[model samples]
Target: MSANGLPTDRLGGNYFKLFGASTISNLGDGIGIIAYPWLASAVTRNPLLIALVAVVQRLPWLLFSLPAGVITDRYDRRTLMVIANSIRAVLTLGVALIVLGKQGVLPSPDDIDAGAVIGTDGFLYGMVLVATMLMGFAEVIYDNSAQTFMPAIVHKGNLEKANGRLWSIEQVANTFMGPPLGALLLIVAFSVPFFVDAATFVVSAALIALIPATKRSAKQTDLVERRPWQVELKEGFSWLWSHDLLRPMAIILGLLNMLGTLSGATLVLFAQEVLRTEPYEFALLESGGAIGGIIGGWSASRIARKIGSGPSLYLTLLLGGLTTFLIGFARNWIFVWAMFAIFMFFAVLWNVITVSLRQSIIPNELLGRVNSVYRFFAWGMMPIGAALGGLTVVLTDAFASRDIALRMPFFVAGVLSVALFFFAAPKLTTERIEAARTGSG
Candidate 1:
């Protein structure tokens, strides 16, 4: 199916080029999660420090995402992506070099190698944070621009099918290949996956360069007519404000986003303290979720085609929440693996369905801006959720009971998803969705 929300004649043409680049970029992202955290944790065993790493990575979106979105709407998405990719490549290579030097694997840095690990007397943590922020800033720009660019490349009728394919590939890269392979490379060299990420960014940039669209012309724009950044930011939110299709889905996903964060942050604790699993075994258990996501991705397009996107989301999301709720009661290895797999499957379903709907309804002219606004909200609350989970353990007897601390986050995450389901269902109907898709086409 084409990516324009129309019926699929077939899936081919220029859109495939974007998919190729996305595959490479996504793999790097998945691998980054493993490599980055492991490197940081290797340096500092403190849970707070590990959590701080996540904070550094995600904080950029909350701060500058709106401006990044406006740029995507106002400029050449393809070119912005090229710049983002190139910059990411440089950062990844620099980090890789430093880590290699620290490990004494680089052989010849001599005096420089001594300064590599704790560079600038631990100032590199801040530098790493800054780089993470820039990388995230660029991510918001690239993601927004890509949303705008996708519909332009393919027909309107097949947005769901096309998005499904992309989601499937992302699931494979993220859940399947990223973690396991990253662990293997970490065994070989601490910075090996980062080096791979650097290479992928270069390749992604090259693939993005292959698209036929010309650079956006600044001369054609009316600079004086542009609204203030604050006003423009509000304008983007307002676009989704009165909409029938996107508004409800956004709220539903927003709650899940929060829940996902809480559940994710506490998962390692559950594995380590509750399940008594070895570190490597915990890694294997974690990968089970990704593997489940792969299965869900494989089936998602078929499910959506049979039941429709809105309905599929409605159903799978319920499953996702239930899975979260079930996490608290988990007792043994069997249950841990089962809950993880179930959680991953439903999460993948949620991702695939929502993306299809957004691509189908959002106007191409406003696509980048609207998506940026969506992301800023949908992703912005994750840090808060993480903090809340931490606090919940601190304030209550949750941690003392061990099980309470370990399981409460899961229950909260699940209930949040369930609560949002009712709020979303009445607003999201198959009829409205089909109409939106038809109108867009």
Candidate 2:
């Protein structure tokens, strides 16, 4: 049986193990979403610093993603996943311990607006930053391995189904259930959520280790091993570049990610300052996106089938742009939650189709390398976006009110996303999708 209660034969028993591992890990990530920013906010009220914490977490994608791809291709992906999760467990435990030690001094959610605990100490912030960086490093390998690992366990036709289920569970774990749990944990004790997350990673790693080994080619591994890393890296880059649809998609996604992060990086401050969200309310705000993600995940295949994949993909860009643009104008937290939900809904839809397409299109031998290269471009922009988010607020603060400065990133991202729609719509035609589907690309 599987998550959806379908027979294991449809997706394979190994996929179920993968799904379980993803659920546990995503739950930990959900907790971190609350725990890291909450801890950061407790340390300082500087929007730039808050955003920098977010930046460091994503920085590994830029620095290590390509190499991660190479390793994913060469190794047993299951082993890599287990190792990555184990390391995450340790790093998260360190964070938990630090939080436990410092609970007496850390600020409550109420003190965030009062400026009482602001700029108190750098030691705790530095510790949080280091832990975040290490955890992110592990995530790079774990996520890369997980993506490549999926195609091995499920048949090509079931890629969409598998991805949809995986994404659905992850959203539920990370966003829906995780945030509220984090909020409650924070109310009880700051250290509790981190400790709970550490335990989840341990369980996640164990689940992954239980997965049976899938096939890998010794000849292919030898071929990759024989080549210089530069050559292997080039092969991945060249493959993506030569593919007309994938090339443009990666470029556009990279741009969108940069712009998206630009707005998203300062969300903690926006929620605190502009929306006036308390700790529990802030957690609920996080859950709003998860609600949409859950719906999108379940309906993705159906919607794509009804609308056609090209239009479905186009809809993501159009709706995501419009919703994000609207978020900039929101004065109320309820409005913010609504817009975030809508944006995430489209985002998940985009992910379901695109991820399945990539898995189905890329050859097994080259999947890891090509996927990594694609992410190197696609996700590599996140750190830059995170920095831009913080800078936009800080620089804009010189002239504008703090609230207005916080809104700048959302406005910029929205405008760029809308502009991208016109450029992408024509290029992302059904004919091109068919061409890729038929391997004509």
The candidate that achieves the highest lDDT relative to the unseen native structure: 2
- The digit string of per-residue lDDT tens for model 1 on 135-206 reads 776776777777767766656666656776777787677656776677677767776888998898899999
| Quality of model 2 by C-alpha lDDT | 0.87
What TM-score do all the candidates reach, one by one? 0.84, 0.96
Taken over the whole model, the C-alpha lDDT of each candidate is 0.69, 0.87
Instruction: Please provide, for model 2 over 17-104, each residue's C-alpha lDDT reduced to its tens digit, 9 standing for 90 to 100.
Output: 9899899888988988888888888888888898998899889999999989888888899999999999999998988998899998
Candidate 1, superposed: residue stretches over 4 Å from native: 1-8, 104-128, 214-234, 276-283, 331-334, 396-404, 439-441
Winner by TM-score: 2
What's the residue-level lDDT of 301 in candidate 2?
92
